[model samples]
Target: MTTSTPAGHARVAADAPHGPAGGRTALVFSGQGNQWLGMGRDLMAREPSVRAVLETADDVLLGATGWSLLGELAASEGESQLADPAVLQPTLVALQIALAGLLAERGLVADHFVGHSLGEIAAAAAAGALDLPEALHLARLRGELMRKAVGTGRTALLGVDAERAEALIAVYGGGADVAAWNAPEATLVAGDAGTVEAVVAELTGREVFARTLPGDIAFHSRFLEPLRTEFTEAARGLLVPRPTSGRVVSTVTGTLLEGGTDSDYWAANLREPVRFVQAVDTLLELGCRTFVEIGPHPTLGPSLTDCCAHRGVTPLVLPTLRRGEGEQENVLRTLWELRRTGAVRAAAPAGGHRVRFLTAVTAETPPPALRGRQAQFAARAAAKALTALGAAVPGDGAATATVTWDSTDDLAPEAASVVAAPVAPGADTAAVYARTPGTDWLRLATARPGTGTVPTLPDPAELTARCTARRYVADTAVASAAQDADDVLVRLRPGTGTGRRAHLELAVRITAAVLGAHAPIELCDVTGYDDTVAGDRVHVARMADGTARTTVLDAAGRPLLHIARSAWRTRHTAADPVTAPAPAAAGTTEAAALDLDALRAADPATRLTLLTDWVREAAAAMLRTGVDRVPALKPLNRLGVDSVIGLELRRRVAAVFGAEISVVRLLRGATPADLAADLDDWLTDTPDAGPGTAPVCSAPGAVGPGPDLDDPADIERLLDDLDALSPEEVDSLLGRLADDAASEI
Candidate 1:
């Protein structure tokens, strides 16, 4: 497939090998403007592997930009300002790259890869075309440079074809440029803010439903040309030559990246229109039967579908994460679709009139973090479901029962329950698709444990309740995986329990069963708690090993679950269990307990020498450098003392000398020697005496001896005393103190 804009950038030929031998899957990445505050939180909790990605990203960004990516994600509301080009560009790249690693852990391979806008950087990194650090550095540089371009912005016009969009720009753009050819009916325009707004007004007047995007600068437009030279120079050190691995369909040029990724290619990519429609078709021509959108949400799923339709192809489009879906469940469901379609085969067979039961051991205790958290109740619910799975007898009549995990139970529930219910052995069954009815969902509910009360278990008949049959959540390529034939689809109600709103934490544990494989699993697409209770049936289908691609649903029959799949294992081994780190403690040395009176009696020079030696020792110990090796006149950052370690230095000084200092002051002091001199002077002229010494006092309105204001605690106390006075009193005191100091000078 080939397409070109008026600029005649390039052409794409379907020359790459279609899908790999097993099955072809293309990993598609979403760019900026798709981040939300709670995006990958649940996934991080459920899968330590995903948590590692989040940690790495946080560390890298924190080191490079002095901003906490994780803190921003955790602190912001749903409508976070991650859209700032500076924040979003780097964040989006990190998110997509991390998600790609997570997906790879689930046995989902990308035969062909493509990215939209900044997403291309992540794709290159995922495909071995670029290293992660290099990609991250470039992304950070791109975002920072783009953020510098102010007064311009981007706007999108819906229901407008590319031709109509271009014509509208010519008519009302007033110097605006078409930024992207997003879809058959969606186009983005960028330029000066006023011009873009004017275009939006003109389009809205014509009932085109236009809106501005969340950015302050015009991207993919000529407005950014002024920054090209500087950006190219900075990007040169950040990007390496692309490798010869996974093929990446370039949305910038609408062709394959033949020479691999490079500084020049990325430089041009920054100002090029995203020919997304053409790029999708190009991947289709390359024989990628399955398309997976990897990111925080499903912004590109619809566009991918439309692109396939435009080309008269029926490609399987999947999303790794959704706005409000269970991340682990959705991923597992995708794997199920692949297995059902024979795109993937199961590791075991079932035919000997024997049903191999799969379940998590509920007898073990849940982790402390899970205790009393929202996911706690979910653990019990999964335990109940596992009990049912273990009790199932082949060819037995329908087993109808409700399993309730009363909050009063002292036993903590397991994180997840992976229970498999295969077809009845020796029963007549055909290779036919049976959509689970909605009314067939099981009803589970929770009650808070009463204070100091032990509750008796409810009767099985009284506890279990079945709802009227209903429709199963319609599959979206299993939502994340494509549907298949010759697959055994069964419904397991392990996830039907309900609890307090916070129990959505249970989403991670409930999804853990599907991720219980020898290889680590990565979770994507986690759901947030809404008021509505999810009463939909949980669908399960074995993909490979003991792994089952499962989906839990809301009352509305929407997929509420998604999980990644790893090689299934019948036995369990916690090779990597999540645990909290030990807390740090401050210790006092004999030097710290030395008498203040001794220091006060010493001469100024002697005191200064002692304080300088102590300061040097503290700095050396904290920085792991020799006392002499530590620079006395250089900034702490020069010795790699980041903010985290700077604070530690402050603590060390306080512990050793009973002298409190602020991290800000310690870091900003001219040098260690200068700071020590100030501290020594304060100690020698102690205002308030220790138990064995007399107080050193001057006249009532006199200046305190030598620069003693370096003590943060003393400064704080001074500020507090000043605050207690009336405004007039404060002014009068300040005037008197200033006059006394001036007279002394």
Candidate 2:
């Protein structure tokens, strides 16, 4: 797993992969300030649908920033740029949405959301912390006030090496000062220029030059008091929603952000340690093995990838791979990654019966045994036939093959002498050798075959890999358990041979029944099955009832089917290489299969529950945004749902919650009026994401003059005027008059 690292850089830690508590984890997001030109260009180009989102962002931003934003805005006011902090925050918001939308389309999402300075706003937007427009305005205000507060302050950097960086900062000036390490190789030093310069002069040539970046402004330092105050005032007029995810990691320390409190996120975030390493570590500890940094310059990309490679973890950063190449690459990568993480591959588990290979009895000493050629052909042919009968291999189409030899020991007791096939080194059923019948096997002398065919087995290696069937998955083991269970359970259809397909279906049913603890059972597998000899004793011989009764009588003519063996194990011979499925069980078979309509007709409560699930699933698939989905929000809201709860419910209940539908359309409208108002806000909020334009729709019908002057006569006079005017003229003139009145005010 050794990966190339940037040269001249010391290994952060030699033993990175050796984490104490198993691993680490972190949530990361780019704030508004970090956005640059070509930010989402890569993602936008990939998914043409996502371009609409970018267009929406341009509609919300542009011309407001008064700076360059990679691409021009699609607005009539061509002069305006969206680089303004206020507008940029929204731009970042839109970018994150478009990114999330693209990811969802392919099925990728995150375990948590984390944000840096302005990035916190985008993070909030990502987790539904605030709507798109509000997030933009907040980020813009933060940037503006922060710039105002700092007032051209300088952040003198000492060096990129953590030790050198810290030593340089300390030697440079820090006495009562702070030391914030951004990464192993980067640190941000904030203070007065004279002292900073003095310290730099003190520690000359120990590291890279004191670069003395211009816009230092002591970002994330206490110098932004005025900015914090202004930002707070602005935040009050806004309404932020609950985060759609569980935790929002604070970039300050890679810890959880305190909800409803911006003091910690604001003050400490600016002035505190940027413990990104610790945050990443925490995420890895939380069971997140993959790291995905979304969009833009990818400044964080190198740091993140280096960290993961150093720590022996996987890093899936977007836009690197995509940025210059354009949106197409970005979108495709996002979709593919999302698909890797987001979608569930439904599997119909495996099934196989246990044939205890009697280890003690060997063909070498006594019992006339089938030749090696005979055993191989019988087994191979039977396996091929079962595969043809619809036996599902793993999704990979390659089965987990396990090899073992049949012994005569389980069939009849004998001394523990050399058997046909010696136990493989790691035989799971090694102890059971005493009970198995022995037979010759191929070059698989190193492989310990399982007792019987396990439908759940991945490859043959799995049987020895697990101790318990439920804890492990072997189609053969569980099916064996079902076959050996005390209950007769149910019967198989007459004239139907118990073939490979039948055993596989039975394995699925049996595993589901036993592991699921026999919850109302539902089983269906219509594929036909064929196998080599499936039983050592029993045969589908005729009976007095004129039915194909299974009997186990030997040459002595004693009934073998009625003989008391719990599970029927398979046997092999050259002639019986292609064994048919066992004949259907002798007696009572299943009456019929259950269908949705019949289940729906079962009980009222059950029916509602089922129908409700169906409706929710439908809603998930047809993800809607803006006005189109407004009507769908009320029912969700009336259910008393919150965003986090809604997300959780969808994950737990809905099959397609991974679709990532709009929270706006799925909530916020308790009534049609509320929904319509929500839609109007969505439409208008697009343009007015700045200081004066917000609080859209003016809360329609809000009495501007305090209830029409509260004069009955004034109302009467207005009515009289309306009556005197022609209806068309009154309507036509009304709009103009209102505009004039507002302009005058």
Candidate 3:
């Protein structure tokens, strides 16, 4: 099949079967060199009809065959299978055919078909060009014979002039040919490895590398002409079918060849250069818009896109080879997106075969991360969208899927009793081709065409206040309230009022760009609230015990916050506690006035690091700095000689220890978190700890005033809070909250 564009159009369409989502005349299949191990193995297991075809593959190849090519290469670092064309051609074919079968099994049919040289045979089989047996037979003979022509194998060069590569090959190495000029400045050359290496060494200003491959001969280059004649004779024995009634491009010239007998297909392919570049141009001429690479690898995709870029035409390349577990699901999903955007006719799942799915979506078109011509907006969009759907699908065959979102203000939750909440059950397979959900934060825009009742503010805050992952309640309530005001319902767990901080608040920014409004404001804090008890939204608590009253006392008069979130909590226990010791006093009053730096400087290398760190920490204490970025300090109770470390530091201080001038004392004239500023200018400092020590775990992004109480009084208050944590009810609650987070993941 060919791609099409207006006579004077600036961009060309790579040949794809589905053409554009809206077109009728195209056939899509991946090219050679794209196989991975185990690509079609699943299909074979699931569909005996498919397995029948792979069985023939076993008979067609020798050592390291196509069966080993598809996905096995991906197992470890530095392992690849881009070498053998014989294995590559068929291995790629296996997966594409499997995908095609899966698609066809569900009635997603195709029309005209064509493939780059090695892919040509697979395409022919797909388009009735050859039977499975005949295709495999032809491919096997072609691979083995090509292997005989060039002993060490070949490589494809991209972003370089095919002509230049050929010249260098002829001048510096054994005879070689520019086998396939896939695109302008993109070429594939094949010959003896040593010879190809020599030519490559002479070239500069281009990216050139060997693709993973089996040690086989060059199939498309002139070096294989001898085998070509021989293979041509052998191919004559098989009754090659007539080229499909519709036009089919010949890799030899990268253009359509008309009215050729069946044998001519084999003859032309044998003697001609793989004209991938010309084929891409022809497709562009044919008015095709998008190209979907069927299987194995998206071999020609990079080239075709580059080809278009050369003449200023940029198009997308969809490789079926990269699809995950659900092949048909991914293909169908891509088709739907194409249809939604007006590329193809809407091919919705009829029914009964749909998989229920829920997904997190963003309304931001081409979200900030996916920008530019260098990338395929449509392809990336399709990949992202489909993958999300896949994520929300349950492994237990649950027809329902749910999606969560960063913003849920507009999302409305079901009432205490609402039947028939819609579950995600889309047949879109884009998910199969999407990046693993964990690898990237792919956000989708959740804009249903018509709206019933999205979500509102007060309700969301009430819901968020239910989960206390965030330690700020009023903050959570306010943010949740804002979402209510803005009509956004976030996709997350329901709230539970249990937390680490007395109050936990999880807040993020939500801006409305699509509905077009004035400047966007930040929705500060969102708290998880529980509804199990007196119907109150407990905004800032880690969890609510199942046994405890679900009704919260806090939200008696407050509106429910409907933040579209899922709720979970778990249990945790405090480790045994350890006590700290006081710093040692200096020997003499004069010596006690020495600075900490001088004291540390006198220590051996090993002792210096710890003592110096303590001094800086003391400075931070003076500045009242709190909470560390990295979780470096082990819990005091976990250390074997916890007090010893502290004692050693104090002794180091006492050695050249400065005077016991409270950092808080100096801070009366200075600022916080920077003792250097309020650095004692009077008597040298000593390690009794300069004063005003900050508390640990002071929540992220907190900017607040220090305690009004004095040192001993503040310490007493802290100890009291720690003691309060032991209250049976409080312990039970924290236990449940911790449990919730663990349960969710």
TM-score on alpha carbons, each prediction: 0.48, 0.39, 0.42
User: Which regions of candidate 1 deviate over 4 angstroms?
Assistant: 1-23, 76-83, 244-246, 343-376, 380-745
- Model 3 lDDT per residue over 623-694, tens place: 212112111233222322122232332233334333222222221222122222222221123234422332
Q: Tell me the spans in candidate 2 whose CA falls farther than 4 Å from its real position.
A: 1-27, 31-49, 55-89, 156-167, 175-180, 198-204, 208-210, 214-216, 241-245, 258-273, 306-323, 334-745
Q: Tens digit of lDDT per residue, candidate 1, span 1-745?
A: 1224423222322453322223367889888766766777666655555777778878888899888777766665654657567777877787788777766654454678899998998988888888767877888888887767776666555567777666766777457777777877777778777777777888789887788876577878888777777777777766667664548888887667786666767877787778887777667666666777888888987788776666555556667776655565555445544433434333222232211111111112111122223234443343333233332112212122222221221221223222322125532211111112232222332211112221121122211232223212221111121112312222333334453221222333333332322212222112222324543333344443444333344544444333222122111222332221112234534443565677777777666666666666566555533354465666555665654555566445544454534443443443566657656655655546333332222212333223334455644565679646433333234434444555964
Evaluate residue 133 in candidate 3 and report its C-alpha lDDT on the 0 to 100 scale. Answer: 61
TM-score of 2: 0.39
Model 1: ten consecutive residues of lowest lDDT: 354-363
Cα TM-score of candidate 3:
0.42
**How far is 237's C-alpha from truth in model 1 (Å)?**
1.7
| Candidate 1 lDDT score relative to the true structure | 0.53
Winning candidate number (TM-score): 1
Rank candidates, lDDT, best first. 1, 3, 2
Prediction 3 global C-alpha lDDT: 0.40
The lDDT per prediction is 0.53, 0.39, 0.40
**Which has the better TM-score: candidate 2, or candidate 3?**
3
